[model samples]
Target chain A: MSDTMTNTQATGGDGAEAPRGVENLPMVKALNAGLRQAMLDDPRVLMMGEDIGRLGGVFRVTEGLQPEFGTDRVLDTPLAESGIIGTAIGLAMHGFRPVCEIQFDGFIYPGFDQITSQLAKLTNRHEGQLSMPLVIRVPYGGHIGAVEHHQESPEAYFAHTPGLRAVSPSTPNDAYWMIQEAIASNDPVMFFEPKSRYWPKGEVDFSSSAVPLHASRVVRTGTDVTLVGHGAMVTVLLQAAELAAAEGTSVEVVDLRSLSPVDYGPVVESVRKTGRAVVAQEASGFASIGSEIAATITERAFYSLEAPVLRVSGFDTPFPPAKLEGLFLPDADRILEAVDRSLAY
Target chain B: MQFLSTDGVFSVSEQSEQYAPYLERLTEADHRRFYRDMSVVRAFDVESANLQRQGQLALWVPSFGQEAAQVGSAHAARPQDHLFPSYREHAVGFVRGIDLLNVLRLLRGVTHGGWDPKDPTNGNFHLYTLVIGSQTLHATGYALGQKLDGRTNTGNHETDEATMVYFGDGATSQGDVSEALVFASSYQTPQVFFLQNNHWAISVPVTTQSRTPLHRRGDGFGVPNVQVDGNDVLASFAVTAKHLDDARSGQGPQLIEALTYRIGAHTTSDDPTKYRTQEELDSWVAKDPIARFEAYLRSQNAPQSFFDDVDAEAKDFASDIRCRTLALETPDMSLMFDHVYSEPHPLLEEQKAWLAQYENSMNGGESA
Candidate 1:
């Protein structure tokens, strides 16, 4: 229907034009493009997970990848998370870098044992003698009007492990670059892609000025207060900052690119400058990444605080209905309310 | 090396010649070392069980009577070969050069995994896998990697490599095991599927897990399979060596089922006395692998000091394990965000910040 061959560059200045290689495509299309590039770059690269082939993935994130790569490379596996990851580990050991999909955040539990116990420790147990060199792609977080087990933020579980690397991307540009970067790492990486942002289009640069997957990026700049978020929440944070700007409050937004081995330098520097910060995410407030960052700021930059660090997070309950998700998710109003509260303090 | 037959007389298989040449290589001194390693590993197993009983561990899977099966096969593997072990392979970990303390740390709930597997010097031993039959798939995959890397049957004894994966009768029932077998058979992956048919899976017995002999499951998957006396260290060693060598030579995947018994509770949380009788326990105890090996060693006129030295070594190793386990420090609570991904994530930053504030507020504005 569209000119698939025309890699038309998107308009310049705001960086909204189609990328040099992928012109005017949706997030899912860009993902498929990245997968194709990765497969061509490395022969060891293979894709396997549930409904990834033939069915084209639940979200069609892997649409057309199977036909191009063939069934041997892009495998549609049986309905077993443990089997998917367990086999991926075997494939990795045999010199194949498997990019496994866990289908959804809630469905990753069955394979949790394999990922945390076997895949995470295979390299460390051999005392650095072996490297898993595999990538696990999980579509996580809530915001889609979906039912139970479909929307969950379980990044904390994997982040707690010692040997695995965890990361998530919010934009099409970061998604394209990060997926390829994750596959090239010697360590095992758990790549969490926000399902809600899968269709959102953004400009991606394939010319490799793209930051490393583990580094943080400052998406929006401000001075009065810092708004920190990631994955789907990054987009929300940027929008919230824009809304705050109309009300004359400057907001600095930090898009933490990596979950584990976090680049706290950018976050701490921003907090030290702003003296006021509001952390927002869709995951529950109990024992979450928000808790870790809040504590680190207090410890590392206690004197810089003009007020206590404020957090606007989802309720400490199961992810609610799509109708309630708007209220449940931290929107511009909730973020601005926290910012106002922090300013008042 | 045979000390007993099915009829209870000293006998060796006609295939013994293949291993007999290596028997003389294991002099009295070497036998003493192997015995010492087994004794220490068994002591570690007992102490781990005690720790679990005392609530120092979340759970403990004892490898009491199955030590010979583990140690014999582990010792038979070359340094270059890799090992993938199920959770119960405590003795195999010891033989593969893992410190006894690391095993204790895992059972004590201090860490999910106790070691790194990538370091060739870690003796190519992987962390203990808790999922029943999953490691079989990993082993097969690793074996395939070895084949592709030109590491198998390189015609150089010092450089050629193979892989061994250990599981139990219960794991044989898992779909992953059968799938791994099929893949290994088709690819001719240089791997040995070492199944320790230890007679029980928690409360379920061997009969409940499989309709026929567990080894036969491999045959249906197209992997050549064999059965061995798991209680006989010499037999286990001979059989595993043959299979491993065959795999290394690119002859394809092989499955060896070691018929053994779980001489203790399935774990500290279990009480077998409810389902099995003391009579069954007594029967397996009489066929204790260590005792059988000891008898054969004595008949060979092995020195009395060898047994004395092994007992002393076991006590010392047990003391070290206890000391190290008791001294382990609780992990930093903030380490909760350390390994989720190799890259930075904005959401995690927000969550970490929120947690810090929550904890500090709960702690009366003091840093937590």
Candidate 2:
């Protein structure tokens, strides 16, 4: 195991089981545990979404919550995405902290107007008289061979908009701590949960949060190259780092927890040391997160760079069919190829 | 059907008997007050339109002939009730205690929104929503919150809270309106959808916006609805009073379609002469809500001094806008960064600081 994984495992608290700490859990279960803790911590925290009550959500991420919290707190909203988001905005105005779920990344467009125009602009329009303490949990990205409208990476759309905080956790531990922190935020947040990382098991420390909500962390340290990515792309970069080490090349990996207000502190510090960098993502490269990170690194650490910052991301096209998602998504091989190219220069 | 005819007579037949008791709730003083409000709002409306023409305002949305419908329905709402208005509800906002100068600020291009709805001075009226039919969903959501907060359906009509949202004929076509109706019906929220079917939405006639009466549109969504002759302020007040009571008493959502007319251009930017005929405008102008209400007040033995006092008050209100409006200063440029996020945001903070330093540099001042 990488030193970062080993450290996280040792300090990890028990998921579902607390004080004594947890051994292992999938990212989805960690999120469930975090949600329960938030509900226990604050009565104002409530949830609303389609199929989130009895069905416990399509991915079972919200399983068993309705039974524990009751129907009023854990609402099974109508199939209308716009209504769900729109009403959640109202609920927030009335002093409730609502965590809404958009069933799929592709299905979120129905609520796009509410999210971008109303929810995003309301706090600004109110001139800070009202605070929208709400979190929109969107299960995004592709890895499962699901059909059309099942998987997407639309975080860039929100990150580009002001008055919204966009974030994605790459590990079970991060998911557990970050979700609670997001719920505690007084401003609106777009919580982009990686669906592909839902079933992956990892240690979660319930004792304390490892890092701030927006801080980027160096997961694996190396002297030659720095690899930066967020969400599921962080996992691919880590894997590529492992393979790169086997070939006698040193590669460091950074896990970006917050997608917006992107700390860039840790990223710039790492790029300054390594002198070369590669950023990866599952989203299309055009005006995407990868393009942004790469540009900033070049601007901030121009003299330290030995090579141009490389980006390994999906091509500019539609999400594609389930069978073709493998080709469309970035994997360890694609990231390694970029790393090798950066090392060559 | 109208309980008060254009000739200023209150004629109640068996068909209108249910609404008579609601009229009994109002006194002679209330009748005179409604006439005063209608006249005052009409004068203010005319002054504002003139301001727009003289370049004192960026634009003006005239409430011209929709006075009775606005005044009556606005009075029907209890002090605790929350109201969401479309752009042209100047008379309603005035009734709700929002400083009319704030509304002037909005049209004067000083701010996107002129007043803070949370301030007690602004009353319980929310901000004006320029997007058609958008406020209906907000009002519905707020009604949902009211239900969840246990403010509604508590068996006490006077103490219970309700929400009222105003939209127009053309806004009925918006998807948000349909969704609001669906959610309101599903949740059984204590609310009222007050739609002003003013004969035109810009250049589009009511016939173009809907094939059926707008109130009937509520029926498909399972909300109990009614159509009132909006030019008759008494009918407007009585019908809204009953419906608001029903909503607060947990009878669920109600829809009141006030059949009225917009006797002016949609905005200062619009020219009604391009699309509408003079005959149409003259016909609606003859059925003016303010004129009929004055006739009704005079028959009730209101003194000529009452008319003189209102005219004097309205003239002062117009001059207040003309004199004070130009003196309203421009907002600070830094206000742009002040409210984008409620919390301390790193990016905005950085940008805010950067702008300050840049401005200082331009001014040949020292920068820290």
Candidate 3:
């Protein structure tokens, strides 16, 4: 289920050497490998979460880590989300890079106060005398047919915070590299893992990442309309781009890697070329990452437009039951329909 | 739970009898130091409240009644140990060698926190946590780090490290406090939860916050718990010394419920008269920690000159803080942006530049 191999690439100057072969692994396994590699590299790296130890997490993303790192390094904390995050802040103050796992996106609210009030502010509160080099790994978004709390996209909450870094990886390779990069960062990061795409396999090279974790990548280039997506929605956007291409729309796809401090440069550049864009996500269409991207594109590329910037997102309703998830989720059809509306202009 | 009777008599309880040796070990110098620290903070506390009333500070959290609880436990900690203080532990910070004026910097709205724990002069005393119960988790986490760093469980008291976190009764109701206890006990972290049960969380009473005594709350979490007469400085010192020694020597976490009272209001903005009875305030005043310690010191043959010197010194110290506070300068506006993150962040940089440009444009002139 998991494999670790060297990344065959030139060494990065700051000692980020992929220094062998890419491991084709699922997103969960790739994340595990990245965490394991980080722990192996830095003594300060530690993992804490509920059921993360003997149970290896509800998602098993931290599987086999407890045994490999020993219980001291891989702590199975008491069932307290606020405690996990609050204590992780304290541990970070004590100079440990703690990666905390929230069992589900909904369960994160219990720890939300710590994340927003304390973890987000400690570094600034101390005037840089301290740094919260912590990563909160949250398995988010829908399509797994799980209950109310399990499937959510709460990136907006973290992204809106001034001091915290929020990022989500849409693929296995990005998960492997980004988790490691987030842990190595000297600031707190909300690493939202798209639970629906955890099993999707990709070539995760251990060699090193080509760009900084914050940079957005153009997964598929096109000309007529640009389709912006992140996390699980990026996969759907790719499908929409392919569909639009066959219809002679030639839609470009941009995977927004970092939601906060968003790499709007590439998105802006793509939109300037395409003249139109549609941002998509599973979150409801109210003050969401989709709304933010649309706003940023509008601000940066307001004149370079064929039509008004549009959004294809989940309706403003509580994430519906498993039976209605397909309708609730932003799929290729909804995205291409948005593409049609944009192309119609 | 009481080492000295409230009537100014030195009498030890059975539970506190175990700490009798630590009391005996306290030299005249230790006693004088405790007196000096307590008096200094008390004077400073009074002056700070006056400053708040005079519009010099935005607010003040008075440590008027729980001096013994803070100072005793603070003195119990070794220099190597880390301390996490809830917002009102001025006496504790004083014992930890922090300049009392640094606390005013926060209440005066001059800085979020005026001192850094990493700076040696601040004495490893963490910045005060205004949010209740949050510091306990931080202390537990830091203690866990200490244990992992092999700084604890070494038989040597001087070498082995432990941590102490202070909070009030109101904070006990928070989920974070309970969670911190669970983690501390589960991880066997070398730590102390020094709860100054001051009987009020603002206008709310301790009775409303707890069904049983607060000390027993930690018992369910596997932490050894004790309650001491927080007004009795000797009891606080002895009990804390023993528990901290035990924790550092691998005894894991301990909870000390220091039974005290908030003689003053919660803050300068609070009116104790509105919520509490005059009779209750009078009763707590009668059990004042400083008065009780001063009486005990007199009974131990302390000279009048020594008492006069301490009182004079406390007054001088308070006056110095007042002078320094009045002379306090506002930090650079750029500080707000300087350390939002350890490394340079593009967003913060942009914000900083925007702020600078906005300030530069204040005179309604275009950029050169």
Candidate 4:
């Protein structure tokens, strides 16, 4: 094995007997580990963003990468979002796996034209002559009381584009595995990191692999109602499931890992078994990822569903200030309220 | 701006003198070949615009007055160097060994893009980026890749390769263009930014695009930049060749603002008369690059038979392109979903089947 692979394997902090035995790590550190492993496995892997090198990113997800791999691989780009993505597209065309960070969700719009017009369409436009093996990492969602643009959830816009794959990981373990999987895939992946969960610790096993990047997973199973969500909202759904269980009402929580080609198979199965569902997200309810989940569940599990598919999402208003964000975001209370309504029906 | 004078006089500035060796290295045969290339592509340009007017092509972006800027720089680039062009770089595409009809396939609305950029026979020329100023960043990124692979800065002129991207004056105003300049400067990527200041950007004049010279904008981004008489093919060739050499030898990025004029409308859809005046247009017409070069070749005792042979070849080439464009066939409808992902996408497969079924329904039956 190469030195980087050995380094990651040794650094995971778990003894060899438990192949899946993991180390307790935050989402950011897990992402860092994933990026480190990916770079070690493939010399072609590159990380580019503002403040990614010395600053290790605003979130520090790419921390220590420059020192470990050298600045050539972990590039510190100028403050230009369009340039970052456009150049990354070029690098991808020239056979480099570029993982670009938009830093925050709100700042991604400037580079949106490049991502949608060039990165997304390059492969299809070139008639398969080119493959864009690129990953655009954006820290999205709200909970830590950040201001506007910083807390926006723009996955719906990217998921709507046919040529892009949008995926989000709610836990550190998934973050570790999915980031590596995204780098390995030939398609361009829009990786949404749940910033609220960046500091949350979880057992991240580097020794073994996780599920495929695009597949949805039922994190916690119940029979009364299916609470479907992804990214940060998955935590809220899990908490709501717990709260509902105490009330003698069972709730199944499904983390929709990949938003674009949402693994509707598991979603449909969960909804059919539970006979009720509620999709939760921090983004506004109008034409959101939650809407797609609700629509898909209704179509695939129409006869099996006892109540209409409901959604517990943020109000259809602009992302408010830090003080009002808590009121705007979907939490366990709102999720429980939606579950109660679904159960009452 | 007039190095090779409009009156067939060849004068060299100190800057042009640095590149004079490149010009001296060229033989009578090379000059004739350059003249032939310019003449042939111009004929092809005129024929393309005519086809658009005659309702053959959906739209045509004419390179009427900007042939010299493209042909000269394209000739200067090494075979291993990657080239990125905006839509109107017809001459560059031709020099890159692309079957020019492939470009027509795109303009004719029969294909998404014409040729595979990675195809070696296509001269390492990338597919044309229709979006203004975007290709500059891609070129810079490709140059960065070259640097990472140790493909450049080897101190060996022949083995060291660089990248070149072409854009118009108006594209310089774009955020992506400025960003590309910033990244190229920061990374010291081996690349050249070839901006053709073709006096008019559709209806907008170059004056409105930048207050200072476009090359000066590169100075603020830390890239060494120069302005050339874009109409003088020799200046374009010499300057581009030198700067490309500098970039290949680890001199970082260089910018060349080629001062030229667009003799035709931006596209067949444009009305240039509304924005530009007849006096300005007539003045630029006198400094036509191909005409001036033809005059210089004649002054150098070029034979009449050579010019006659080039003219004949240009006519035949134009006719050949017209025939190929007319004979172009639409690809299978299934091709739409073919390259959406390298791996099969279930949703795309379902949509492809739906479209096929929808088309079959129009034919009064569904396939088994």
The Cα local distance difference test for each model comes to 0.80, 0.87, 0.89, 0.89
Q: Which lDDT tens digits does candidate 1 get at residues A146-261? A: 89888899998887776788888888877877787788887888999998899877877565444777888788889999888889999889888899899999999998878876
Candidate 2 residue pairs that clash: A13-A22, A13-A205, A14-A21, A14-A22
Q: Arrange candidates, best DockQ first.
A: 4, 3, 2, 1
- Can you rank all candidates by lDDT, best first? 4, 3, 2, 1
Q: Determine the TM-score of chain B of model 2.
A: 0.97
DockQ per candidate, 2 decimals: 0.21, 0.47, 0.56, 0.62
Superposed on all Cα atoms, model 1 deviates from the true structure by an RMSD in Å of: 8.0
Across B176-209, the per-residue lDDT of candidate 4 in tens digits comes to: 9999998899989999999999988788878898
Q: What is candidate 4's CAPRI-style docking category based on DockQ?
A: medium
Q: Model 2 segments beyond 4 Å from truth?
A: A1-20, B366-368
Q: Mark the 10 consecutive residues where model 4 chain B has the least summed lDDT.
A: B1-10
lDDT by residue for model 4 over A278-330, one digit each (tens)?
99999999998989889988988999999999998899999999999989998
Write model 2 residue lDDT over A47-160, tens digit each, in one string: 999899999999888899899888879988878888888888877877899999999999999888888888888888777787888899999999989888888999999999
- Candidate 4 docks with a DockQ of 0.62
A best-first ranking of the candidates according to their TM-score comes to 3, 4, 2, 1
* TM-scores of the candidates in the order shown: 0.71, 0.95, 0.96, 0.96
DockQ of 3: 0.56
